[model samples]
Target: MDLAARSPAYEGLAIELAVEDEGWHDAGLGDLEAFARRFVEAAARRAGVPDDVETELSVTLTGDAAVQALNAEWRNKDRPTNVLSFPIRQLQPGERPGPLLGDLVLARETVEREAAAEDKRFADHAGHLLVHGMLHLLGHDHIDDETADAMEALEIEALADLGIADPYADAPEHL
Candidate 1:
């Protein structure tokens, strides 16, 4: 993946983006990289990070098997998830050096499956996952009702900017 163009928020940040493809065999690599970068930019803006914040991040697009293993190892879940974020560490006070935000791993198969099940476009779902992962990189979580609501609202707004409809608006009744 090529990351020649970066988000304005990462202008002065000594950031290195490494994109890895694990044989997903669906979408083109360029599209995936662009989508990942867009997600990072949106998330950075939402987190109130200045364009000059020195941050480094990486993204990996993998198949279900790889993600399933990761989910099992890290999250203790047997099944593959749409996305997983691994943040490195938080910077302490007066730590003026750049921070490594860590990696985002996305499952191509899971993303497609969820998109189909939710009656949404695959690209839109992928975009949402990217944004979701980026938020995680920024230390956001939705383990509770209130946090979930706020996170979902932010996701909706972010998706809207990409001309996507609210993903949770027409959730299945059973859910």
Candidate 2:
């Protein structure tokens, strides 16, 4: 697709997608922009963001190699992950942010493999990850048990809005 094929804006946030992997073309995931907006709005609402939260969230669809390189460079992990969220800046309480909401990088291969292994539809898993990533961009984290619980619950709520089942409901041990 070319520049003219860019998706329309959702709510006050503009979703820009960059598909770098050929495999993504045939992934059967439909209307990614709409999905991103749906989850993002839900996440922002859960985060207490106002209805007029204007921002641009760039969603890059790439492969495991790209994600692994980023993981290694930024998180010091030499492994491929499903998604990475890079928030542009941290906003203080009662503070407004700039137009950019940072970026979300997704590994198509890793996400596909995980969905298959977990007996989930790829789109559903992607929704979960997308919400998780957006939450991260909104300054949510899972660094500790308490924080993890809150974040996971928020993820579950967002997924529910997308009509996806609770991801952790069927999660295997050691996840």
Candidate 3:
């Protein structure tokens, strides 16, 4: 999608979207602006973001090659991942957030494969990943078992608000 198609604001949240993969259209994810705006707002609300705080987020929908390149450059991993979150600033506990939240990059092929493997709708799975990435931008992490559980719980709650099923439910050990 073009920059002009990016959503300017939603409940004080501004989203900049880049659709670099035509596969997103081929996969039938029609009009991601509204979908993304709604999910991000839901996540911010669940994360206790105040109404007055304005935030900015960028999302890129691309193929595995682009994501793989990013992964190799940023994280030193040469393989592609489902989603990548790059938070502009990591907030401290009880710290107020800044205007620029971060960016999210999603790989269409990997996301689609994972969704099919998990028996989830593509839209729902993508929403889950968006929520997961948003939480990361909001200073949540799954670095350890305790933190992982906490983050997972938060994800479940946020997804619940969106009428999405618990992504961890009825899943394989690896998912």
Candidate 4:
């Protein structure tokens, strides 16, 4: 069965956490609910989500099977990715967000594998992913070189604020 938690706004954003896979509960991540709240809220602030918008969003921690299904249905990938963001509506940068933002779904196995491969602490990697997903929910994309650079910069700044190492530090610089 899924375990869920919902609390009042954290600086104008209400974040709900739902653990859909037992592995998440057993992952020894230390308070996934609080982690999600803190990272997403910080991301919203960093991405200029507007403190007065009174937004709401959900994060689901699940396994690859579920994520694969979602990916196939929504994105037609037929594979499990680390995280997926499903936004209620796409907003332009600087556009005021709304009461309902979007949902972020993460796969536990994929996240763990990625963390181990990248030599990152699981929590730090997950936190970075949360920030990335939050940016996507706010309509930030890396579709073009310029936009990718801007989004990556915002992600680095946001993750730094949360005390996470820059996820793209080792990535080759854009030409």
Candidate 5:
């Protein structure tokens, strides 16, 4: 059975959580509902998905070791990244999405460290990654210049909806 069919709070968005990091608990980021709502709302707004449409995804919060393994296995990278996204499927414009959009894996320590280095609030940085991962699930990519521009613009706009500044603004010469 579909998990969304069994839940009441899935009013168009459902996020299954796999939390393996204790840091999230300390940072008050372990609230799956709050983070999920922020991510899903940002994605839906950018993708033109209506508020009443049902959608779902999964999020995993883990330590650097765990994320490093996934990064090596998935992207041939040996180091830990702040976030990694696995998109389940692609949807055309105006098409209804399935129950699962994709999975987002986050490295707790890496994210925290990056936020501190960048002089950003942890929640804001985390929110930016969630928005980024959510966009990837919706078939947005940054593989080329044009797509990267589009993707970045969408990300900036969606992050604005969450009251987050454009994460790329501080990037040197980036939009």
Candidate 6:
């Protein structure tokens, strides 16, 4: 599937996609951009943002070490999580020409491991995580059960729109 034509909802959002991993040669650039765009568009829609509204978003795919450092520096965690979102809040509504949504960081190893554990394809799992992270960037969080439920529901619907199966369908033993 061509990433450019997949999501009509994010036609105006400017996405900066970066692949920081040497091991990610197997994944196509267009495929990654498509997944990231899908996630961003879905999250924005859920947040009531206009599809045509200009927004700037960045996504980076990297190995465990880079993500681990980001996790430690920003979240105060010693190890890398599956993904991390850093939303840019300093941009004023009128002062900024367009919204700088924020940044998303994904860990390659953790993503692969989770995909395998869930008995799903790596690309699908990556898409799910990207959506989850984008939601967080848009100020959606799971701090409480009610919020978690709402967020998860949105995630399910978003992933489904991408033809990905419900990521939470078969709960892992750890859950």
Tens digits of per-residue lDDT, candidate 6, 1-175, equal 9977675765778989899996665754357776678777765666557666777888999989999998889879989788988888633212322568788888889988988977888888787888888777776777787777777888888877767788888864211
Name the lDDT of candidate 1.
0.71
Worst ten in a row by lDDT for model 4 = 1-10
In model 1, pairs of residues that clash are 9-51, 13-54
TM-scores of all models?
0.80, 0.86, 0.89, 0.90, 0.85, 0.84
The most accurate candidate by TM-score is 4
Whole-model lDDT, candidate 4?
Answer: 0.85
Tens-place lDDT per residue, model 5, 1-175, is: 8976764433778778888987787876567658767766776678777666676788888899999999999999999998898977876534566877888988989999988988888888888888778777877778788888988888889888878887887876332
Reference-based lDDT, each prediction = 0.71, 0.81, 0.84, 0.85, 0.79, 0.76
What is the per-residue lDDT of model 4 for residues 1-175, given as tens digits with 9 covering 90 to 100? 3334543335678788899998887777778888898888778788887566688899999999999999999998999999999999998877777888899999999999988987888988888889889999988888899899988888899888978888887756421
Give the range where candidate 2 is weakest over 10 consecutive residues by summed lDDT.
89-98
Q: Give the candidates in order of TM-score, highest first.
A: 4, 3, 2, 5, 6, 1
Pitting candidate 2 against candidate 4, the one with the higher lDDT is: 4
lDDT (Cα, tens digit) per residue for candidate 2, span 1-175: 7757755434577789898887887888767666667777777776666666678889998999999999999999999999999989975423454699889999999999999999999988887888888888888887788878888888888778768898999786312
lDDT of 6 at 38: 72
Q: What's the CA RMSD for each of the models?
A: 5.6, 6.1, 5.9, 6.5, 4.9, 5.3
Model 1 scores a TM of: 0.80
Q: Over the stretch 1-175, how does candidate 1's per-residue lDDT look in tens digits?
A: 3556654445654334443544444564355556677767776666556667777787887778888999899989999888988878743322332467778888888888888888878778888887887776776667787767766777777777767788888875211
Candidate number with greatest lDDT:
4
